[model samples]
Target chain A: MTARLGPLFEACGAQHRAALIGYLPAGYPTVDGSRALLQAMLDGGCDLVEVGVPYSDPVLDGPTIQAAAEAALRGGVRLRDVLSVVESIAAAGGRAVVMTYWNPVHRYGVDAFARDLAAAGGLGVITPDLIPDEAQDWLIAAQKHDLDRIFLVAPSSTDQRLASTAAATCGFLYASSLMGVTGARDVVSSTAAELVGRAREYAPGLPIGVGLGVRNSAQAAEVASFADAVIVGSAFVTAAGAGTSGVRALAADLATGVRRPAPQPA
Target chain B: MVGIQPVESSTAVPDARGHFGRYGGRFVPEALIKALDQLTEVYTEARSDPEFTARLNGLLADYTGRPSPITEVPRLSEHAGGALIVLKREDLNHTGSHKINNVLGQALLTQRMGKPRVIAETGAGQHGVATATACALLGLQCVVYMGEVDTERQALNVARMRLLGAEVIPVKTGSRTLKDAINEALRDWVTNVDTTHYLLGTVAGPHPFPVMVRDFHRVIGLEARAQMLARYGRLPDAVAACVGGGSNAIGIFHPFIDDPSVRLVGFEAAGDGVDTGRHAATLFAGEPGMLHGALSYLLQDSDGQTIETHSISAGLDYPGVGPEHSWLKDTGRAEYRPITDAQAMDAFQLLSRTEGIIPAIESAHAVAGALTLGAELGPGALLLVNLSGRGDKDVDTAVKWFDLLEDK
Candidate 1:
């Protein structure tokens, strides 16, 4: 069954313009704090929220997200705990997805995982390394749960690969802004616009969300201008930690600037 | 219709999701998350492309020597209480171990991705030599990051890799060994992702890698399966191999994962002893923790920091086993037990004396396990051991262990 995610996006008022996406590491301070942070992000105008399933070794994460995961793990946040929190947030009128590595799902059991995650209020799962050819069983399980299995894209992807990812992914496509690990960058990819433009051809009408190192309003605005959605992960995760209000304010401020029309290159 | 095997479904547990019953997951940074996602996208395309699998199999045959033989060691079997002993001789492969299988596959993938440079970290130098060999053959620039201590101990391997045109960088930070070298390699990979490919040595690390490496090494079990059928007419009673990062053992065990009758046993090094506080028996003594980018059984303390490991063999001196092995042990698909340094040394000497095969210290652990089981199983049962590598590079370590280096 095709996931009817477009309506959800439209219902969230993301149809008319680029959606502002925020990311938070689940159980950063505690489960309760993550819930509050997620709520605050939504209230502050985030159209969608991505919750990171804190894992022990975050190889592609920068210092900020890494520290957040360490804190979450220290707080006894297992994969099940993350799913429970997702259910809680969704119960409280929020739309969220899980961003995690592929192992936790394996450990949690794939078919059971998709069902439990769907039951716990997750709309989709974004597993960065579950190569498409290998995803059939899990995808079938995900489809059984009616959960979206989002795919990612980069400048390195060929046209054929982009098409495969687009065909496999649902909910929205996560387009990496850079090739490196997640962290703030000094400059944007000179090819980010082109990458999104190419992905558009592959997925056609799928909503494209760009992320990885978009730490500020300027960067968010630039990304939003190119794609259907702008995803801010490391920056939001760094700022909106357990007890910090700085992240909330920063996210809100960036939220305003992201919706504003970006300046065209000369 | 695809002729499916019964145990095959169990072996591919995560199916496409990359799970090994809850222990295997991607625990990577968010920045590379997207890149990994992109990689999964490309990998999916490659898997279905017939051309990709054909090319991979072709390389395995033409370059790395596909269908590595299964040798029946009647003399050694008699020594191990007359149990039927068969050696899945990965040691006979071009670079003398199963590590080449994964490197060749990754090097091909790197070329397919249009990457130019290959980076790797080595502790015992087998992986470095294999990667360097693959790079030289493929004409890719190879940089091998090795720990300072390991470089000093395995100096000959450094020379070997350098001769193969790989730049050997001695990492000096942290414990100044394999772990540090891995950290440095990851740093290099992150910084140069556009042009460089990291040829991880084992079936550990983040997602896709364990899956990818295991897929490449499947040839080991695949070949053994057919050869064993031809030689013995049916499946064996058990499969035995040494476990460090668990690549060789996984390579052999993965193909037999669905063969419920094939009892899979992984032998880990016990250094001095498992309980004696000096060992690399991660599965025996380690707690569940994170290291080298995945949550696996690790020789780490309460605070999640890695502990120093001791093994008479430099190759087996690591504080962690591969993540998939951790899952395997937990799920009871494989049983991981310990072999003390003395026992391994004894087995190493015995193999040399009995078969004229001076097995690598790491492979000695498997020899020790086979002997332990062979004595129990008697002459009728069959045990397949992955004779992982040749022992020439480990001569100094063996000489010192046996006190044979008094004057020369």
Candidate 2:
């Protein structure tokens, strides 16, 4: 069961720490900004990152995230640019996972992508759209290249599904904190904690990261209590979408958010 | 685990996971994740509650005129070289299409959720018509986004939607067609997640939709099944329908998925020709990829960008089919074949002349398939085809294609 990403998890675990994960749409404002945002996320508080390879249609994303994707596409950010962004992020001492839809992956050739990501500074690849049953070819290639193939688990997953999904999962398990697309919400669901607990039971020892709709410090702190890592996607995307100063301020704000107590005390 | 007992009817319900044989699951972005989760919860409650089902059934029976009759097309059958042909009359429903079936269910669910408005996208305008009809009945503010090109070609449908009190917004982006309309509608839903519900037309999109739409349309097949038994005293040898995002085909095919004795064939439109780059035959020529939020077979370029697709029939001119349809094709549970514009036109004319029944250009694809398959099956075989919609809106196009304007 020992693998490449396992070492990073072990290192973080030994430090008695949690990872602050960030997500940014690749090439949102500009190519340079995309690379700079990755470095900023890591320098501020992010321990690991998810880089979105923008596609024409981003179905699961909320308005803020969708705007970021559209902006990235308009700026001529293709999947190839994402690889270069990962390479630069790695050079600057950051670890990232290319989070993309299956279209770009298929277009680039899965084997070639797996090899390139492994060579770049990427540790894993998470496809939110590909089910475990349909991920065999890519998973095999990812494993061959020593890259973790991460999968998304929702609260709606059945027991039979939970087992099969956990078996094939690598890296930290991604637990969608809510049921809908990515955006800030009024409050996090109480069931999210229970779902994460069930997922942790299924994939024992693997770190569980919760993402989607984790916006401010209060939400982040609450998620941090239950998760090994708290991933803020739309928040980062929304921040990076603003000018460079906004991105930095938002990243710092998120760091502060995660360190604060839960909005509603336990 | 070897011999699992069937769940008791008292306890049995649609899986909480929203799967129909492992094909439907939420595979989407984080932003709308909670919204869909909420929808799933609401839908689950609605599916199990007799009050919901009873009300929906009442709408279908009284308002939509459902349990829509099955007519034995003997004359049409004799023309198909003597194969016994049965037509399920979904075209008789309000709004003149099977699209009403799915919309009615979603509308009821929307009302249950206390949504004040409904949003939808349309291609050939059948879905827009149905959605508009539902909104009018429910008094929900209806807004339909249609591509500019479609609005021009389908002017009457646009007017019909307006008459039904829907605000038809002309989308002018990308290629200005169905795909762009969908993109705009999705953007709308993300922004207005609280007050609005997107009434997806077909058995496609992300998870819950394909499962939900298919469930609502399952009544079509269920009623047809009993009717066939009563009429023929035995099961049909094969079933056929056209595939445009594959909702109508799936509606009729789902109940029979486990029946190995029956063969299901879906026909896609190959405009001009399949090799001419002017066709919408996704299953025939497309590769597996993600589009409009679902992992399915999509007509796209090597760069993963969407490619332009064409079909004489506007409804079948989409670049992607439903994800379940792609899965079914891959698993060989259903076979997909292509029909050209000329052949469909021939079938369109034949059905109208023979039976005094005009069919939608999209449904004409299936009528063309029936002609070929019926001839091959000879005199004794039973074949059921879902006449999904009426061709009134398509009459102008049909007239132009046949050059009947000069004769008239």
Candidate 3:
């Protein structure tokens, strides 16, 4: 079954636009501060909010997100705090999901983490480092709890891997725009559209979310022109340093970018 | 996911997907799966290919000064209750450590993959030097990531790597040690997978790394076992080595795994003490957790955050041990113990004065443990220890620690 995300993407598809997805660390800056910032993002028209759990060794993240996460961890951000943030997002009438490396959830007991996340009003989890091959227990848990299992596909992924990943994923397939860690680049990856096309060819029914290096509205528009979802992470995390209004402002700008009509195929 | 048999034995460990009883498996990003698969395939094919084996064996003989001899430390053995203490002299290798064994093999693999650039992460700089050495010999571009703290702690080895034409990038993230360096190297691999091959130094990391690295260094055990049999007419009662990411220890332990009569002992670094919350003794005190692309024993907090680790020896100052080591510990096939800095230092000094051979601080941890094991085993019991690296790069730290360099 698809994530409750179907309606969100359906609404965007009706507008001939891509859904805007925003990412924020659950306890960044401060616990309550993150909730307020996510609230602002939702208010600013983000269709979906990804509540990131800060980890000690975030090998997948870029400098901005890594530094922010280190600060949050130093401030004693816990998993419960992440749940509380997701709860706040749900309480504020917003769609939410939790994204983190696999260890914390595995250490907490996979089934228990899934149950708690479901209870906390989170729809699913995005495990950047967890592929479908090594996600046996997590997959079982996500299924038992009716939670969406979102997996990523990279440009380097073989057709076999793309097909398998698309088959395993329930939510939108997270297509890494480039062969790099999480960070914003000067331009949206030139290979993103091509990768998204491959993903569409493989999945067919699944929505594709292009992420990594989509910082500004123009970049978002570029991604939205081809994919079903425009995912922005480092940009929002960097903007959070400027405070909630800044986050909301950027979210609104990005929200507008996703609604831009796709350029007619030549 | 493909199952790999540990070399020289029918041992069925780390089933496909690389799980050694839930300890070793790939826990990395999907972005790296293809490269890892490609590496696994190349390494798998290279193992049985006559030409590949001949090339690697040839380098080991000529380039790395292969079949590193076993030295009987008679004078030092007296301090250990007169036990027959034999040391496999990996320290005499060209790069001064057993790290060259795996580095050379992987460097060959890089050539096979047609990847011109090689990236590595180092703790004590032994592995960095070895990687750089192999890169130089093969004319490959090399970049080494070392913790900022270690570049100063191991300044001489840093210079050696530079002299070999390897770019050294000092990582300043997370505890600023080996763990962070690995993270940085993994990031670099993700960014440049097509152009670069991450020459993982130790037996840790994702899948094939643990088994592949173990296979490359398996020669240590294979050779030492034969030496023990030919010279002493029997296998030693025990084999001992320092456990950091467990490459050296596993190198000397693999062939002996099925030898029920022989004991396999690993000494993990205990900085101040295990109870002091500052030690790098993962097998001694850590719980099972995922770190650096594999499920293994790691020093992590209640929330599953990797605990910052410390050790007087930079090489042993890691929060995680190799997954196979974790499997060995769990299966009761091997035993691991904590060795404190003070004890390791005492052993370091003892080896220097008595045997006229100074060991790398990492190897000294094993020496310290060996003394205790020797005393327990008593006289006449044979103990084979892996003297993993030489002390040349550590002389500065030694002078400062022992106050050997006076104003004169």
Which model scores highest in DockQ?
Answer: 3
Give a tens-digit lDDT track for model 3, residues B222-251. 889989999999999999999999999999
Total clashes for model 1? 23
Candidates' DockQ values? 0.09, 0.20, 0.86
Model 1: per-residue Cα lDDT over A200-239, one tens digit each: 8988878888877777777777777777788888777767
**Model 2 lDDT, residue A13, Cα:** 70
Residue lDDT tens for model 2, A122-185? 8988887776766777888987888887887877676566667788888888887765677877
Pitting candidate 1 against candidate 3, the one with the higher TM-score is: 3
* TM-score of the second chain of model 3 compared to its true counterpart: 0.98
lDDT pick, better of 1 and 2: 2
Docking class of 3: high
Alpha carbon deviation, residue A214, candidate 3 (Å): 0.5
* Candidate 2 interface RMSD to the true structure: 4.6
Please state the Cα-based DockQ of model 1 relative to the true two-chain complex: 0.09
